[model samples]
Target: MLKKQRILTASALIAVSLMFGSCKSDYEKLKASNDVAKKYREAVKYYNKKDYNKALDLFDDLTQRYRGKAEAEDLFYYYAYTNYKLKDYTSAGYHFKNFAENYPSSTRAEECRYMAAYCSYLDSPNYQLDQTNSSKAIEQLQLFINLYPKSERVADASKLIQNLRNKLEEKSYADARLYYDIGDYLSAVMAFNNSLRDYPDTKYAEEMEFMMIKAQYLYARNSLYYKQEDRYNQAISYADQFTEKYPNSKYLREAASYRKISDQGIKQAKVLVAEASVDSKVAKKLAKKDTTTGQPQSVVGKQNERSPQNQ
Candidate 1:
């Protein structure tokens, strides 16, 4: 009985040795199979050295190989950052967006979202150029704020939105002012009108109102005699708006003066027409005289006498 028990014990020991040896062999195989952890370390080393291209290649390969593996999140984040540091903004934006969408509940998701928006913001053109990226950055950042209302990054997003909006505003105002400078009164009016619609509460609103008045006034001044009536009315419309909106503005006095001149010119035009219709000879005499010569001669004689109410 003792001998049989020894044989059974030895057999059990051999079975355990084979199982342990197989486990050790498998561990060795995994260790030799291009150690992912070692690759991750090397990639980080390359990134620290600012060899972005090499770092990016390693990070990209690791991210794909370890899609759902232990270090996948860290690897993917560094992958996106590598692209960003390399100034490959489009690819950086794409990877960052992907990171945000795929890892919405991850610890770094909010940061990923913000970085995605910032990537586009970084690619925005100069203030004078097409602002497609600038517009997109605004929309995406607003969306990010909506998504993470209580994020610590909210302040940054708000500031970035303001900066981008200011760019658009600057472009609009510059174009509007250019129109004013070039004497395209109609186009100037349109541009200023659109600018106000876009930025009604801006500090430039006051300046814009002044510009609008000037444009309309000039438009009226340059109109043909036949077109003067309509143009004058348009000038009065803008002048009235300025006076109503900025009652205490320094430009108010000038605006009022313009208003008065337009009113007086229209009245004088009517009086001249009425006089010419009644007596062509006196009208011709008055037409040859200058009204500013400090002369008290009766230019409107019987015409004024005929319309006492108008006197």
Candidate 2:
């Protein structure tokens, strides 16, 4: 009885395997066939089933063949989205932009345009990496908004643009902080100023301003004695501006302290300058006196004075 039951189970398993193999063979035959209509239909069926890889393969094959045909529009749309579903964002972005350009009058054009920009946004790297994609995403999103001012997607595009811009701002802030960390105070001050100029409303504004004051102070402190007074004055000016702009800031106390130190530095720098000037004048006087009296007499004068006619 056990042997008989085992034989029955083996027969059932073989039947199921053959059925599955036949289904797979049918798909393989369809893939190799020259039936364009059947291929297109199967591609759509696969797409609906969320088999994006198979759908993309068929769509790619049908793309040029369907060109100028009425089916091309839907075919291209599906093709673009299939790439997107497969997470090929760069290709998706290109195809989506092409779709928007090719079917400007289509109702899907606006959505495709926004999707193109959003894909670029999705492609943007982390804040520490290069921001070319982030910048490109912002531009694309902005263009979408400009092209479709009343689009419901405009709000979403605007938000995406802002997010990209924030990432760029973060990159700029980190670069400036790098200059500071490396003790390149002058470069740090310039970089921090550029960060502020580029992003006037950056969340890092307060911290950047405070850092500018500190950077400037350190730069002034490290300058040559002759240049210190003016540089320190500049630092004091930065500190004053920071304090005036953010009086209630947590960095206010530190900024004020920097200002005080800069003021003292300016005073000391002036004293050093004055002492240097006095020392320079004294050295010049002593040099003139040495030239006039301390130098050896000329050979002719010594010879004349020691002549035997005088003896």
Candidate 3:
């Protein structure tokens, strides 16, 4: 029985290999044939069967031969789709865009145009990669909307734009958070503030605002006494903004505590500034007396030291 089972499996494998080999043999023969019509026929068959690689090879061969002919419309349309189905999105995008531009009045033109831009959307990488493709996708999608305001795809395009925008926002948030995690408090404060400015309507707005104030508080706490007063004041201002916008925020209590600490920082900084100013004024006054008396301060100090009725 085991010997019989092995024979059956071997037979199945041989049949499968023969089928694939015959398909390859037919494709190679058609490729070498000078008949564009036969090639087109076989390309359609391959496309219908979802054999996109074979379809792509044949379509690529036929594009030049069929150009400017009546058959070019359907041929070019399928050619672009062949590339798309092959997952060569960059080439697909270009070819699809070209088809729409070349066949402006075709019923398929609008669909191809939308697909071209959608391909770019599909090509956009995740947030961890460079954002060049994401930005490009946004541009392409927006242009599609402007060109085809009545297109049924416009709503889906808008949703895709927002989704891509959210990804960019996440990258920005992560960059700011990284600074905070690395103990770069001042940079974190600036980055979080910039993020909020760039994406005011972001879903991360509340969290960003909360982090910004927290970053500012840390920045103020670490700053030199002379710089702390202004930084602490900024932290307080951010906290106020957060409270006003999201009074019911889950982070409200923590944010309030950060604000309180910032207030105390400002008070301490103010005291230091006052003491510094008083010391500066006293030093200047003594210097002015020495200058008016036409004596060096060191000489005056020595004279005072000697004259002390000690003799």
TM-score of each: 0.69, 0.81, 0.76
Lowest summed lDDT across 10 adjacent residues in model 2 is found at 290-299
Off by over 4 Å in 2: 267-311
Report every candidate's CA lDDT: 0.77, 0.83, 0.81
- Cα lDDT tens digits, model 1, 1-311, are 99999999999999999999998675455434587887788789889999888788778667768898867878888999999999999899889999999888998899999999999889888888989999999998999999999998999999999999999999899999888776677788899999999998777999888777767655654543334456667767888988998899978877776665556545554665577668879567545542211212121233432221243
lDDT of 3 at 304: 37
Regions of candidate 1 where Cα sits further than 4 Å from its true position: 1-40, 60-72, 264-311
- lDDT per residue for candidate 3 within 57-82, as digits (tens), equals 89999999999999999999999899
Q: Relative to the unseen true structure, what is the Cα RMSD of model 2?
A: 15.1
- Candidate 2 positional error at 248, Å: 3.0
- The RMSD of every model to the true structure, in order and in angstroms, is 18.2, 15.1, 12.7
Colliding residue pairs in candidate 2: none
Give residue 242's error in model 3 in angstroms.
2.1
Give the range where candidate 1 is weakest over 10 consecutive residues by summed lDDT: 291-300
Which candidate, 2 or 3, has the higher TM-score? 2
